[model samples]
Target: MSKNKVHYLKKLEIISKINTQGLTVRSVSHDYNISVSTIKDWLRLYDSFGISGLVPGTSIKYPNEIKMKAIEDILVNHLSKADVLKKYKITQNSVLNHWIKRYNNDKTLKQRGVGVRKMNKGRITTFIERIAIVKEIIASDFNYQALSEQSGVSYQQSYSWTQKYKAHGEQGLQDRRGKSRSSDQQLTETEQLKIENKALKAKNELLEIENQLAKKLLEFEKDVTRSL
Candidate 1:
């Protein structure tokens, strides 16, 4: 599996959650900290090719004529992107977007080669870098794929770090295995403040979720009272 790519098995799990468990794309996105667009892409791909569609580098290489036709259906016939994807079985919008850009620019329709694309392997990162990437993931609305590419780490790495940060605070991001207690316990004032701040953020987020649930519960109770 490529470092930057999400594994097909994980994609299948997400698809199952949405399809079999009756979860909405947005809810799955929130729970998994992935982008809604990315989830939608996976759903469309799975719809077209089942588990195989979710596999990285399995997309079909369309002829130039097909590309032009798909683009025309969108640009001239006013088809929705989703509709076009279904019609053509294209797995990703990014590919069609590229074709659209070229067609609009009056470029010639040329068939591109098909095959797996080469991506750089994920690189190791320090503790500080992990913290920065996790912060960026939160700031970007939990777009883990984008952060993974930007941070030169695997999607798994970015997602795991964020999960740990949420579940265990700053200490979760540290790789203290095989280290002595003295070094692990040592922390500068600023780093200590960061740990405190991250914990508070996690607590505040929990509070926000609880507050929303409480409001919904109150609404339900009011409806029950009115009915009685």
Candidate 2:
């Protein structure tokens, strides 16, 4: 037992002796080197419920391990909130509130901070120049890390820029922060439609080439069969 526990047990034993032997509180406190008020308090507890009441009243609010385990099981196993609460000895509302708060904070953190550097005209222009250099390096069959080193951009940033460029084209290179709808002067509707149509036509031509190659292969097989 801890020193505190030993002290508590000694106090209880002293109080028990005073109660049974009818020893005075002042005399017992002086002999035991304990306070008189402390002896009085112990005797009061002893009188109230005998030996059990002499033990310290537990005021510590220990968290329920079963409830914590239940929460863990619910999260790890994807169990329903009601089932988790029932298994863990916690209220349904407590479990729901805890998870909802956790999910909301996680989502808020994602939306609030992305850890990317703030963009400006200087940064945007530098990024555009680097992007051009990266494209040139890629055409020459340089790897992503080599392009990153050549462009003075991290590999992850270079990869992210490549994806953004693919998704939004040249406009993606422009700084978007603090910009409004008025700043967005993209290609006209007719121009966008024309570009899309041209891309579709290119895709169709590639597919046609592949189909012709397949037919040529079949014809070559037929000629070989005749020769055999």
Candidate 3:
């Protein structure tokens, strides 16, 4: 939930404690203040493939053998989607669902790459487009999945854009390629100027919107007072 990466060892330890200590998923989740879904995912991965399945990071490539085995376990053994997910150590049930769909349509078990392929995977998004998508996501009550489906962007992309927008406003959505601000030394004059300009532009836009909203609220209040 914090967006900070949890080490796989920590996840494995939590799952082990749940099993060896006979703790319920809800109890473990409440004790650690982690979401129940997160804990259950860890348990499923560990149970399905042992320690190897609990590896961290999203860029992991599942071998064709593993994919086929998962399919067989589900189709031939008549396992439920959840059961196959737990038995195959899949991180997302959607991955299995996609495989099932592909098998049904083509009778093949080929695994597609992660994320939406509409714009060549990590698409180069314009600042205006990113801002619009972020705004639409906010209008949809932060439904990342719905935003991804409707906008043809991956759910991870939608979520990441929203997070960047929240953290740094519109400028955060900018494609700051080849710019690293984590260095100890001062930034170059050009880099500093670019950053300052972006920040100023974003701030000015935010202030203008805030001023408009304030004026509208004041007018509405005055109308209400007059009517009363």
Candidate 4:
């Protein structure tokens, strides 16, 4: 198991907490605290995957004890990581880090921490979903109208997604459309009309060129008829 200074400090706290309560690493880590391997795994996760891995909480995607237990059970039963991910909906990265944390320096496996807890904020769920959408938009370079049509979210919601992305970087884009912008971001009808007018003028100029070419063809046909 790998860990950083912060994670090591957290482990010391877990150790102290358990010691004050007079518990062993096996019982304490499994019940009162996350496993030592889990701590080291989180540190490793931080080292390799960065902060996203160490974020404390559960995902809306998977919120069942039986399921979490199934993960540990599979690992204990000696099933592969790929197999665990297939049975459960979690990503391979998540499963790997979780198991690494669960086993840490301890060789034995335990089910004491199977108690499932709910994630705290409803807004976080929304924020994560919004971030996923914004990431898609940035990757594709597709704007709001296209996103609205494809995603079946409202036009206003799509624009809100972009604004949230532009303002908040990745974290701001997470699970939220964010607060409303000032009126200055809104375009007036007059401004919209001017834009439309410019487009129409450009189209009309293209049509005029096509019409002049047709006239030249007609003149050429008349000359051919007279020559014949």
Q: Find the candidate with the highest TM-score and give its number.
A: 1
Worst 10 residues of 1 by lDDT: 111-120
Q: For candidate 4, write residues 1-228 as lDDT tens digits.
A: 233334433554554555476666567556644656554344343333233334344232333333445555565577766455545444335655665576443333232223222121112224444655555555434443344445555545655677866987645544324766545444467754554565456456656866896686567545644643
TM-score of each: 0.42, 0.25, 0.36, 0.22
What candidate 1 gets wrong by more than 4 Å, as runs, is 1-5, 110-228
Predicted structure 4: lDDT:
0.48
lDDT for 52 (candidate 2): 40
Taking the tens digit of each residue's C-alpha lDDT, what string does model 2 give over 107-150? 53222112322121122334335446445434433344444555
- Candidate 3 lDDT: 0.64
For model 3, the stretches where C-alpha displacement exceeds 4 angstroms are 2-4, 58-79, 89-91, 104-228
- Per-residue lDDT over 1-228 for candidate 1, one digit per residue giving the tens place of the 0 to 100 score: 222377767777888999999999999898878888788878888777665576677656664436756877887789998899889898678888988777556423322111111132567777767876787678655655555666788656877899999999767888878964446445678975775576467557756876996686567546644643
Whole-structure CA lDDT of model 1: 0.70
Candidate 2's clash total is: 0
Error of 2 at 117 (Å): 25
For each of the candidates, the C-alpha root-mean-square deviation to the true structure, in angstroms, is 17.8, 29.0, 18.3, 27.3
lDDT of 2: 0.51
Model 3 / residue 158 / CA error / Å: 47
lDDT of 3 at 165: 90
Candidate 2 vs 4: which has more TM-score: 2
Measured by TM-score, how close is model 4 to the native structure? Answer: 0.22
Q: Cα lDDT for residue 5, model 2?
A: 51
